[model samples]
Target chain A: MSGPYGTMAEKVLMKGNEAIAEAAILAGCRHYFGYPITPQTEVAAYMAKRMPKIGGTFLQAESEIAAINMVMGVASTGRRTMTSSSSPGISLKAEGLSYLAGCDLPALVVNVERGGPGLGGIQPSQSDYFQATRGAAHGDFRMIVLAPASVQEMADLTMHGFDLADKYRMTSMILADGTMGQMMEPVSLEAPEVKTYDKSWAVTGTDCKRPHNIVNSLYLVPEDLERTNFERYERYRTIEENEVMYEEFMMEDAEICIAAFGVAARVSKNAIMAARAEGIKVGMIRPITLWPFPKAAFKKAAEHVNTFVSVELSMGQMIEDVRLATECARPVVLCNRAGGMIPSPEEVLQRIKEVNGGMTK
Target chain B: MTTQILIAGFGGQGVLFSGKFLAYKAMMEEREVSWLPSYGPEMRGGTANCSVIVSDAPVGSPIVTKPDVLIAMNLPSLDKYENAVAPGGIIIVDSTLIARKVERTDVAVYYIPATQMASDEGITTLANMIILGKLIRVCDAVSNDNLEAALKKVVSARRADMLDLNKKAIELGFNYAD
Candidate 1:
């Protein structure tokens, strides 16, 4: 609630997916192209009704592939544009996300993930952690991946996601789950101003006022392509240095730390609260940006809590990130639930106690 | 203190709407409230249910594992969620559809023939409202003025004709609660 985010209005209950759409609208996003997918169709549905009223383009593209292309087309005109989907649908748009990152264009992508490896049930799952954070598409590119823990974050992240995409001239993704998508909570939202950007790279139909800009993603010369790749990686480094967002809860004097993001983080919060109530000295570090992975928070937490639990919906994807972040300095554990099942707070609390017992031995 | 409630019935029986009304009521009172519905295949003309949590502090988890109050419109919902009620929890059952009684002796049970009450009043769909009225008497999570304001926001203008009937049903249930 504090920071230079923006002026938020009074509180009102909004669904996470609907709030995402509303935030996109507030951020002056006039174009949205997405395919219908469970747990995330609400994004398209809300856009379908709201966009027309605001004179925005809300098209249900033929497919996820087509939707991302439509986003590319819209983004090239110096306007905010977005596309949303679940895990499978995001995979379909992986190539386009690569293209978006390649062209140095700004775009927002929302993935309200459902269970998956292949058409997993339409239940909340964070199985796409590796997919979203480790490069959703085939390329050496990075996206500003934001993981929202609540419906309020679902709305607020869309505002910041667009700004970060435009600020860095790259793609930003709101990595949410079906739980955050379907859950309802009080949110205070503010409408963004009619924004203008330095679109020197945009191929605007400028009436010969300036030279026409060509927007394409083809690099034949290997030397030229390598230069562009290195340039993009430099920008990624800046994002990693400056834009890594994370949250630390009750870390001081704590012996056990829970590292999670999004819905899993919400589950962990409840478990941490219960553990603290029972005198367990447990804490949590929630990664707001999945790309940067908040290694600094882990470093700070490792000074006290030598044991960490990577709570996730997958068997173990983020656990790898935690291990690499801590550099194996601390013993890392996993408490996971796959195939659309959510890990309850009690289950996570039990894991904390078990890990604590192991530490004593 | 936090009040966790579960409202369940067939999909067409206004199960979700009743939960939403309570959630909206809590929100109007500036209380931290969360409403979570059982989504996906479980809610397509089949059994539908929702969890509503109202608290003074921030709600930690939206999923209600054990409910402080259970509003069951039919037999199956009662059978399914009966065991999930906490000790001393209140079970409000629609006697019109559920013939079985609450088996737990630790909890208080209030049986209301909501459907029959609505049908007798010539507004059979007001059963949810009737049960809500009884809940207001038992829980007192929100005041009547707040509940009415929330109902007005929920009811569309085209359904204006049914508002009076719903009000009557709510009042009747409120007075009939024993």
Candidate 2:
């Protein structure tokens, strides 16, 4: 496929996890800290092998917690940085995620999701849906979550995530699954246009031009902490207004709507096609940005659709948002498979038929 | 038309390398392609598989539950993935390692002695390339010119010295397919 520049024909075979690492480097990310875990170890392995070749720093940290903290440390210095892990490891980084939020640091965290409430299977799962969108960390901060269904998006979103993080002065996550991380796809490697940041707020040593910048999460006074929380909420409000991304297919005169993201969205696409073949009016709504949630798009589709089916690799995590977005105008149903198993196209089609039948009655 | 494939086998059996070759060939043809490997615990003593998808359009999903073709390098791979090939798909088996024949008649199955051919060519590591050559011939998924270009590109940086042996292995496999 032709790249953005259209100068060079672009095609390089890359695994999804490896593409994330490559994209980070291409986006001028100078530091990467991560722990080894199933499905997502390639992100670290790629960085370990390639970072030094490009004069970047790659650290195999002690744990996911330490890894995220290391990312925060480097990010506070106005350098692009990233950390990645699977489900359980992401849970370990939750506390650090809150710290990043409180301090308003720009960093990228990747969760190559595996099945989990706990130490789940090493296969792909969308179980982290709630954790990613609902702020796995404590407090009222919101994150920018990008869900990539293909390896190319895995690379593209990584670069974009860094930019968004810097733009919003908040952490951004590429919420993928084991399937994405393990799968290989054709990806083009191009350096993104370098973006410079205002490092006046960064904790670099004080020079003659400016006083020292303090990077801390501790606003000890209750009112001071509350003000910071409200400020962050205001930022999230701005993000929601501007950054919601969604893809709509065949929704023009649809009776039933299928809502999904990441791998589930891929399967849902096949199911939507099959349902259409069967003369069922089925369409799909795919959220590219999960945290912004694409509520407006869902609300728009709800005006016409009779039923909305949420397809995911997890049981029912994303359904709540669908219900909220659609305002219960339509019956929201879920078709899911968890513990590392992916939902089949047949399963999704079956649910669509069931929902279609219910709507007619 | 584009096809997504998974080639699986035991470690050191060249399953991943076969997928890489297919991906490279597709890329040389200027087609969209990807090659994903089975990592983590599966890489040690367990079955290893790599997913390769070649498409004209932007590939929406890289994960393939029902592959258009499967190249099974061992008995385990055959047993595991034989049922997963789509109807009217193709299955390539290594006769030297896989003992059982595929029971499904709906899909075409081609048995090649890839390891034996590679040994005959005095390059044991080229077994994967041998199967890849056969895949190109039977599937005709990519053109011969594209395959040559792909082989050159993949081998150019890492295995430049062994390009001649690899090329010979590919030609032998392509010629022996009759």
Candidate 3:
């Protein structure tokens, strides 16, 4: 991080949205199709300017649905492709996303979420937790979801997200919020190493040299459909077992644990350190990947503490995952702010104090 | 040392740019830094603000609920953030625009007539840079030389013509801060 932020990974100041776009370029994502939306519009704007320079396609699709369908088209040819949108826009693309997942196509979908159920507000919100983590469309499938806390992680996770998608031949998402999307920080980006996947399965022109690769979700036979689903599920299990990513902060012998992710986790760290200053045995468990929730981290917390707090921007959406992860053995409490309001560190500290008082009593 | 600063003003007044300048200066010195803006609806022709953190250690949260330095470029900004400055922190105000006095006695307050000075230089847009001059001079967050170097990097080639005036503005505030 020191020395000149130049050459061999020169550091540059970039916002989270623009960083994601830059990382996409570095990760060999040459095709970009997205509609502009508040908070996340910078990603598309960045792509529009840079994509053409690098011999890439940067199409501003007519709509979110068109954008994702374009993603499907580009991904079919086996080149790295991506689309980005906000909450409401993401909802529209859900159908296209399902089609991509169903066809076993690898592509990147970025959701820099805003307040919503309707058009709610343009401020930051994690209300889309259920939409992003659980299946967004009709059917049973999960995309590889990476939650980035900082602008740096916004870039880092994007690079890794594309890799994971191609490795598993499944769609991957960079689930970010309005806060991280707009914030600026210094980030170092490196070109992705040559990691080629055997894309013999792509619907590229066979030229009659080999059998045609048919990419479709339709397996007319019920048995074949069920087998395809089970096979996908098998891959999901491997992802759950191996692709789980999380971070621990001051959890050793912590009397109280706060489980959160993304911006909430960033805010929680401020409170955790403040609580430690007051001699409160508080720690944090930050889930880096939301889908494969780090159940083991919660289990680790369960071994040390009986009280767990879920800090989030939504009304206890992620708290359910914490409860299930910890098996309801511990009292899982919630500290949240809905409708784009962010909780101050003092407020989080008050919650920690309340939980600590109950423990002492 | 850790300097948590909040710079606030109108959206077109270079509020975020001022914060970015401070952040880049810190980055040049190899100090840990973060710059987070108040985005969304609030950024459109309304009050815009950004939080900047420069620390010897890695930054914990880019969001600053209570900043050690509050730089107010307008009266509305002063009204919104005057009391939020931590006790014993510094409050730098643009005296030409904001007429209200900060009533807090625990914090150090400096009133720099940045707008008047920039207008005197015939470039009203550089008011933010003028106030920025007083900030680094007072806080020593970054050396004047490094701040000047960072200024060179931040002002893009499109507006390369304004660099000298910006330097003059910085020197004016630097002399006026103490």
Q: Evaluated with DockQ, which candidate comes out highest?
A: 3
Model 1: colliding residue pairs: none
Q: What is the C-alpha lDDT of each candidate?
A: 0.87, 0.85, 0.89
The reply for model 3, stretches above 4 Å from the true place, is A1-8, A359-361, B42-45
Return the TM-score for each candidate structure: 0.96, 0.94, 0.97
Which regions of candidate 2 are displaced past 4 Å? A1-9, A359-361
Better of 2 and 3 by TM-score: 3
DockQ of each: 0.54, 0.56, 0.70
Local accuracy of candidate 3 as per-residue lDDT tens digits, A22-80: 99999999999999888899999999999989999999989999999999998998999
Error of 2 at A356 (Å): 2.4
Task: Give me the candidate number with maximum TM-score.
Answer: 3
CA deviation > 4 Å runs, candidate 1: A1-8, A193-196, A359-361, B42-44
Which of the two, 1 or 2, has more lDDT? Answer: 1
Residue A303, candidate 1: how far off, in angstroms?
A: 0.7
Q: For residue A268, what is the lDDT in candidate 3?
A: 90
